[model samples]
Target: MTDLLETVIENREMVQPNHANMLETAHGGHVMKWMDEVGAMSAMRFSGETCVTARVDQMNFERPIAVGDTAFITAYVYEAGTSSVKVRLIAEREDLRTREREQTTESYFVYVAIDEDSSPTTVPELTVSTEEGEQLRRAALENEAE
Candidate 1:
């Protein structure tokens, strides 16, 4: 079994001009792609198999990451199915100078583990051992319920 906290992944991406739109804010597509990549990594860490994005749910862009800012992406597998892992993701806009961060986007992504033949593969059940892990699971479940 994989613990929720063990599957958590956090990464940062500098928002270059190419990553931004005409408004000088990070592009939605670029942000989505980054989240997908991070979510897949989180799922693979738990499943021990190659994973691909299967679905994205409730994606909301609450704010934008401006050019020259750092985008902090966080992902974690909160639950598992026969072959699918449910991941919770968050993106925050960070100002390195002031060390302030505001959440820019949030979403849930589902990934399915695949075998060498590209067939869906089974994954171990998810476990929540620590308080932090349990808290993440509960928050994700509650958001899912909404």
Candidate 2:
């Protein structure tokens, strides 16, 4: 078994002109790419094997992250099936100087662990051992219910 907290991954990306759309804000594609990468990292940490994206439940973009702001992405494995890991991902826009942050996007993704032959492999069970981990898992479940 893997503690849910052990699967958490956090990453940051500087939103530059190259990653922005015509509106000078970070593009949705770039945000999604970051989410996917972080989600895979979390899944791999739990499974200890390569994982592939099986499905994306939903992606909600609450606001635009403008260029010059930092995009902070967080991912954690909340649930696991025989071979699939369910991940919750959140993206925040942070002003580095002021240290202000706001959630900009959220989503849930499912990843299937794969072995060397590219076949689906079993993954460890997910457990929430800390209060914070329990809260995080509960929040994700509630969001999905919404």
> Where does the lowest 10-residue lDDT sum fall in candidate 1?
137-146
**lDDT tens digits, residues 1-146, model 1?**
98899999999999999898999999999999999999999999999999998898889999999999999999999989999999999999999999999999999999999999999999999999999999999999898766
Q: Which candidate tops TM-score? A: 2
lDDT tens per residue, model 2, 82-128: 99999999999999999899999999999999999999999988888
lDDT score for candidate 1 against the true structure: 0.94
- RMSD to truth, every model: 0.7, 0.6
The lDDT per prediction is 0.94, 0.96
Candidate 1 colliding pairs: none
For model 2, the superposed segments whose C-alpha errors exceed 4 Å read: none
